[model samples]
Target: MAGAGWAPPRLDEFILTEPLGSGTYATVYKAYRKRDTREVVAIKCVNKRSLNRASVENLLTEIEILKTIRHPNIVELKDFQWDSDHIYLIMEFCAGGDLSRFIRTRRMLPEKVARVFLQQLACALKFLHDRNISHLDLKPQNILLSSPENPQLKLADFGFAQYMSPWDEKHVLRGSPLYMAPEMVCRQHYDSRADLWSVGVILYEALFGKPPFASRSFAELEEKIRSDRAVETDLVVEAVRKDQEGDASAAFSLYRKALEYFVPALHYESDARRKEAIRAKVRQYISRAEELKVLVTSSNKNLLEKGNPARELLKEMAKDKPRLCAALEVASAAIAKEEEGRDDSDALELYQQSLGELLLLLAAEPAGRRRELLHAEIQTLMARAEYLKDQIKMREAQSMGKEALAESVRSGCTLQ
Candidate 1:
């Protein structure tokens, strides 16, 4: 090692360039192969001096897990090497940088875009779960993006990972405090579901722009995690305050945000009676949220009716074709039902019925403005139908708890 400057050790196989990131134990550098192919990679260099017994164990576990796993959404470890001073891990290069930078650059991601990333991450987690591997340190900084344009998520950083099954439990604390489950933060026995709690945090950050327990100091964050009930109650009390003040929009948003934490809280609760009681409250909250959604939607119905020129255009274009016109009318009713926020299932069925007819008509029609307009209308209806499907699925998942929702996503049902 260079005494003071601590320059990365020279290697014969690759030309290391800029530093990608650094942590307590290692520094990752962007590098290119020195051979004919000149393939790019990220090389993690761990100083031998930094490896205490626990860290050495963690390093071995990381290598073992990365070497055995092969998934599109998880970073690939091509090879590793070591010298007197440092151990190096050569990994697949992701040009888009880590998710922490991605989120910071954008401030907050749109829900649709965030959901895509979440789906990819969920798929990767599902792969690990199947093999009984738990990525204990899951966070945006540890997740990579394939490239800037049309970026794909790649789960990276397995330094704290372990092969722990759902039934397996450990008392040793692991993972970032902000993203850690209450059990882990409180230094109690925790299982693989702790990773799921981290996932919920990631999802929340993606949608809302920051982790729920973010604080200026570690002590503040620990207090928030330890006083789980206080945190949960604060959100609910504030939401109720807003609801009483007639700020349905803000209240609705807060209620939804609270549910994100509430689900994980319910999952982490060990006592059967307490869990059942919390579940009942969650159900009550879900019911109230549904009512608020309808209230919010009904308040916006007139605005929806007034500005819907696109629907009018579709109706005008289908005037000559009575069947198409009838389908368009049915779609209009579906839109109204959706805007009313009552009977989402009815709205979905109506969309399906109209889409069936519109698609048949669209296929038979020639390539002209009418066909184009009709196709566009079909796309709009499909989006609405899909949104309704998601909403319905969310309500059902809330009833069953976080595991069911996460499992549904991981099973590729939502991905399709």
Candidate 2:
């Protein structure tokens, strides 16, 4: 629930303005400065007690990351202030709501428009990756475009970024589960490349009008990311060989989560302090022998996606990853038996359903020791459930769109 009225409404002397949007834990308000010509800004007021403890830590890391960044593509973090119970984070204000709404209204964005947005975003991400800072949350909601003197997209929200510079240890999982990488679905230390998977999700949404990994529930979503169902081509890639482990196997799930979260950190910051924190637990993406590192084509776009060898390397790791293998085997057997007409006692049904529900509740939890693994499992399950529900909805709406299009054509309107 959101706060009905502002708590201690007066902004510090430095800030000036009113609320922009309301969120459960934080309220983003449009603010301005008395002294500066550049007064267009957003002040986020957060209730300390309601936030996840890690979110606070991540907020501090965001400050550190922002202090070092001077990129045009990234949002400028103007200042920070704290007064007792509240923290005031002031950033450049974006009039445009978010990329999500922008794309949603237009349905499919033109390739040229997408190329422009992707270019700046990729450049900003490239900078973060090089600096060992992984913006783990790269969803459209975090990206703001401005129709200003200098119109452009500015990447915001560093809450989910991992600082690979200092103590990039294998901590609990972070970021929205929907945008998480396949490796992060299991438990593992992750790096900068995980940001790439997020970018991949955004791209998928750009093309399909929704996310590739989606769900009505959190557990079902996790199921989707954990399995091979998400292993699809954004651009065509020659299959070198299959990851011998079957889709049901969770062997490389941890490895997938690792690449999903961490590798994106390595693209920009080659700083050593961050390098020290990269952690041994961060499983490298699998590698295969005797293949071209990349191919250049219209789809491949100068072989950009292949440049990050992390995911491919993880595929090789599929053979050695064993943490979830046994559990997955057991779970798969249970499924098979149920499919083959094994009786499901009411108690058994209740237990299995409760287990899934509990996992999802845990996934929403940002606290806990094995947050990464727990979140992975929760998301995997949720993704699966979400997929089934979405399939049903799509089937129901399948003919409606066609009929509407036919009616429109009959009435003489352009198909688009």
Candidate 3:
């Protein structure tokens, strides 16, 4: 080893431990701190040489978004460091890796696992919508599960998270081609509701084995987004309304199936059938939509809520994940720990668990005291989630190449 050692790449501050993944513009590697007991972390190395204006804008957006928000679902930005070769953004090492890998082989997760995932996700979404933050790019690729037991469904990659007030609509076409909403593709002014649209796409994927719009090629997929012409219940209602005029048998059946709840609102040529169908379908949708509610506010004020059942149905959902079978144990321990007078952090754990369950239901529910203030709680929880995410620490530099070999072993995976 030469004494000069060619100035030894400045980021010796963090010894490169293991490579998590490699993409066109960035490479993610697990690393550790050189000074602090060699603590472990993940480092995202973006080759500035290949970065263009759009990439730079995305990087800046990521930094800005991470700076402002924190939540259990959103990935945390630990620190920033650089060297002669490239820039490094250190973050919490989510041992489970990216959801892309999880979904790649399995296609879909089991309902129990999906329930745990959706619940936390809804809680985070409620938090973001309350604060007017819309995550435009919400897909499995951007979700990471760090702790299998108390798995944190961290919403990773925030290059597209934008702030939108209840009334403000963000007019931008950006996101993974597969998960992009119809309006977002059509250049329409959209707000929090757009997030709901994306949620619908995620829901479809969670329910079915593949994306509702999965295609063979990029161009073909984009065309579908531009003009799906599928049977959307809302579209059906407009077409079949007593006030409107449009008749096509196939589209009608498609709409009928899509709007399964609007049998009464959905009328045919016969007036007698119209009222009965409308009443039945409307009631059905109304009930189903209500079931989708993530939170319910009753005067009784019960805090601990259940998990989502739809996720429990996922064929590939994990069987050993602690949250599934040990809700009572986790809750009991949390309560005991919280009662010990630590910071009131348990404030939202129950909320996250229960909200996750409700979102899993996805049924139309009648408006009542339970969900009247749900919109506000969603916003409140978003803020709290952001805080917890930001508090995560970044490890210092250390020699990780040789050490990371052990991480390749897949078993008994638990967060250190």
Candidate 4:
């Protein structure tokens, strides 16, 4: 309540221009402060007499949550007024409308644009979840864009939001069926993970032009969510799309979630063929990891060359670089062993290329603590590369010797 006084202001203090929209409990209006005509805001007017006790409590809860949280990607609550007839909430006006309308006009957003919005939404949700708040209802209709051109998203509509502890169990279903988590649909205990599941649904809709679990009826939709049948292939495609759009973090996060499904399938699989199929799925995750690493390294190089001041990007790379390098080493060794009696050129090439990408980072860094660590990594990789090269050469020599012996045996047989 930045400019609000102790008492509620008269409706005359604002000039209501046009009706933004109407909801079940409230009507939104585009309005301006009378004192400053240049300043515009959205007024959500809720009729007090029109609601039951539960609805009133929910409205008050929204106000409480909105007042406590302030973020760039979250709509701001600037002022409020309580009168005998109505409760007016003054909020930041978003001229670009909600994301649902935006998506409707475009059919589906381009991968780059969707990736940007998803990252922003993830950051906003992370902020809320870190503070123990669950939005409970997250969808395109609730995501407002700042403007048509910029399309900066702001999370709105907190009527169903709840504040819960990490260990608290939630069994109440309080969201749209299409966006609801499986636990929510099943009336089982859930937590902040439900919001993340909603995010996945939103991401799917953004990418595929329709919700993954879409159905004509609520029952069918619930069944789809409970089974999570539509998400398997779509998740992988969306992950790869994000990687192509150069959003390594989002791509990696999606791939990691996809990997979770395969892990359970692999564990419970009794049939050898089905187990092999699960192993192939696991290998896809490994491939995604490698692709993400390549994208991250390329972006890091560009940032370094341009002298960009994106410390967060640098921090992410530094944090994950070791684990990524270790995975690559393990994959290389496994492939080499698997191809021991055959040509292991592909495995050797993969090892060398991944090592080269790691070494490239050393050139971009100045001599410091980080550079020192990179030097140590380079030493380790060089040793591994040498060992792999020797193995390849020995295999090749053995192969050549066997060929020569076969040739001699053929010649002796012909002479006989």
Cα RMSDs of all predictions? 9.5, 24.2, 23.3, 17.6
Error at 376, model 3, angstroms: 59
lDDT of 1 at 386: 63
Q: Which model is ahead, 3 or 4, in terms of lDDT?
A: 4
- Model 2 over residues 57-143: C-alpha lDDT tens digits? 877888888877988889888888877667778888788778888889878566678778888999998888778788887898888
> Per-residue alpha-carbon lDDT of model 4 for 1-416, expressed as tens digits?
22334233348688776678778888888888889466999999898878998788888899999999999999999988978889999999999999999888988777788899999999999899899998999999999999989878999999999997778777878989889888877777888788988898897788667887778877787776555232455557888899888778567656655564455555455555545555556666756665664665465345334432332233345765775455445534634542463644665566577567666667776787666655655554454455446445433433443343344345442222
Q: What is candidate 2's TM-score against the reference?
A: 0.51
Task: Provide TM-scores for the models.
Answer: 0.58, 0.51, 0.51, 0.55
Worst 10 residues of 4 by lDDT: 304-313
Which window of 10 residues has the lowest lDDT sum in candidate 2?
A: 288-297
**Better-scoring candidate (TM-score), 1 or 3:** 1
What local lDDT score does residue 120 receive in model 1, on the 0 to 100 scale?
Answer: 98
Taking the tens digit of each residue's C-alpha lDDT, what string does model 3 give over 227-295? 524323334454345223422322333333334323312323134333434434444433432332112
| lDDT pick, better of 1 and 3 | 1
Cα lDDT of candidate 4 equals 0.72
lDDT of each: 0.82, 0.57, 0.56, 0.72
